[model samples]
Target: MSPRDRALPDEPDESGAASGPAGARPGAHPSAGLSDLSIDLTAHEMLRRAHVLEALGPDWDPVAALRDEEAAHDLLYSGLDAEQRRMYDELVAAGVLPRRGGGHAAA
Candidate 1:
């Protein structure tokens, strides 16, 4: 390899090392591995449970419940780095505010 080539940084293509299922060109989205789109079931279940709890208002304390939701969001982002954690928190906070209704929901 030429010295200049060695010194020059290598730029990753737009596909970024991704490839489709059939060993096709990385540019082909159809061949992207299924694992890349995998969902974390535990996190999914936790969020679902939180939603159910939110819907079951009479049985849960509003402040405490929001805390639990925050914690769950925290747990979900535990695998992420610092910047990712902030982004996750931002997403969670966006939906965490209480809904406005003039009076309590009808029984």
Candidate 2:
């Protein structure tokens, strides 16, 4: 390696390749994976879950709906990365999930 290439840099490594990100160390911000708290589920899956959540809003309880709605079993709870899953739960609890579809029948 050239001298310049071998020179140790002062900057902390944030690239999550090879050696892993510096923030990946224990007690760091959870994991080395990037997260903007965006839902990472597939577009189709997200849409479906949002429809389900909204359709059953207010008077609807998400837990029971998950039980009643076959597709919801793994919709928001799974097929998502850790951060997204956390955000999904928070959105559900806060009842701010998308209300694209009008009602359970609409969903």
Candidate 3:
């Protein structure tokens, strides 16, 4: 589902306003839910691990940065939340991506 479709009950609707106060919201608390939008460790570590991974090299290699495809993918997806992963998997299953083909395809 799109972000619009996933709007919280506290979020503004088409009319644009939730029928509640600030403290009355569901996920309004700090310790409640999803407190980690800036929690992409693998991404944050990329620049720090650049010397080890050599990601900025003339020949950027995933094999060196990450052992194999699986490991590389693991690191890539390590940043995603459950909902994000689910959406990604669903898109993959549907044979579509956010970028649906700016290039020619066989079929």
Candidate 4:
């Protein structure tokens, strides 16, 4: 039978008790038979998350955020001390970093 045609094993009653599957004990927890991996979000929590995304607005650019992160990284690593430059050169020689202009690694 198609999945939709099959009856659910445990349906909730009006009072939120489980009218459970065959061989299940009466008045067992509503989620007794469910997987622990599932997430249960209340209506208010779902609406809060929706509002947070909506507040980010249509002009929000994930790419711009990435570019800003890259800029910050560059600013932080722009000038390396002599010891740092030596370690960077060693990393490049070890194939950990790609070689860049003037034997420096890209920030």
Candidate 5:
């Protein structure tokens, strides 16, 4: 399901205001309840990891990084909260990852 499929009740609808409080009225927080516009710690970490991964020269290998299962798990799981961890686990279990044995896919 899309991120919109999972939204908090208190979240805003579309605009920039919040759902309520802080002088926010209903439908005021257009940005609220919108996970697509939100950014959490996990998202930040994933972007950072992507940058690091990209920095690895094309000629250089990704085996070391991918084979370090513990580190990979830790890196990916580090900033995730309970719900995020659950989603990550679900994704892994569902084989959303392109590689087997938790290693990076061969290019």
Candidate 6:
């Protein structure tokens, strides 16, 4: 879910007063909620997060990012030297890598 979907606590009630713990005073320290492990983001931090999200764009897909990373790793390791290929063959024979091509047919 996007960050905007997150709900902030301590929202004001219809009376415009900050609704918090029943006994909370009007000017109580903001850290009163820290004991609950809740963190209040600074304005600068929130802006930074917004900037990052904007840069990612609406079309960004986490699954696609993972696929791109895997493709990059495969390309980087695609060229195995003769000795490495021999070891890879041995490992494949021993079921270390499970099976060659990982069940995907070659292009």
Global Cα RMSD, each model: 18.7, 19.6, 21.7, 13.7, 20.7, 18.1
Give one digit per residue, the lDDT tens place, for model 1 in 1-107: 45544433475433434433445555567635445566669988999999997788766688897889867744644477667656645655576533223211112
Task: Compose the digit string of candidate 6's lDDT tens values, residues 21-70.
Answer: 55566678867545555667798898998999899999999999989977
Clashes of 4: 0
lDDT of 5 at 73: 55
Error of model 4, residue 38, in angstroms: 8.6
Q: TM-score, each model? A: 0.24, 0.22, 0.24, 0.38, 0.26, 0.37
Quickly count the clashes in candidate 5.
9
What root-mean-square deviation over C-alphas does model 3 reach? 21.7
lDDT of 3 by residue, 1-107 (tens): 46658667776554334534433454466444444565558976876887765647778775676567556555655567677767766776677843223322212
Please provide, for model 5 over 33-52, each residue's C-alpha lDDT reduced to its tens digit, 9 standing for 90 to 100: 44555556998899998998
- Clash counts per candidate, in order, are 3, 0, 0, 0, 9, 0
Name the weakest run of 10 consecutive residues (lDDT summed) in model 5. Answer: 98-107
Q: Candidate 5 lDDT (Cα, whole model)?
A: 0.60
Tell me the whole-model lDDT of each prediction, alpha carbons only.
0.56, 0.57, 0.56, 0.70, 0.60, 0.67
Which candidate would rank higher by lDDT, 2 or 6? 6
Q: After superposing candidate 1, which stretches have Cα over 4 Å from the reference?
A: 1-57, 81-107
Error of 3 at 102 (Å): 29
Give the TM-score (vs. native) of candidate 3.
0.24
User: How much does candidate 6 score in TM-score?
Assistant: 0.37
**lDDT by residue for model 4 (9-105), tens:** 6753333344556445666876666666866779889899889889999898989998897687567557888888789889878888656556674
What value of lDDT does candidate 3 attain over all alpha carbons? Answer: 0.56
- Cα TM-score of candidate 2: 0.22
**Evaluated with lDDT, which candidate comes out highest?**
4
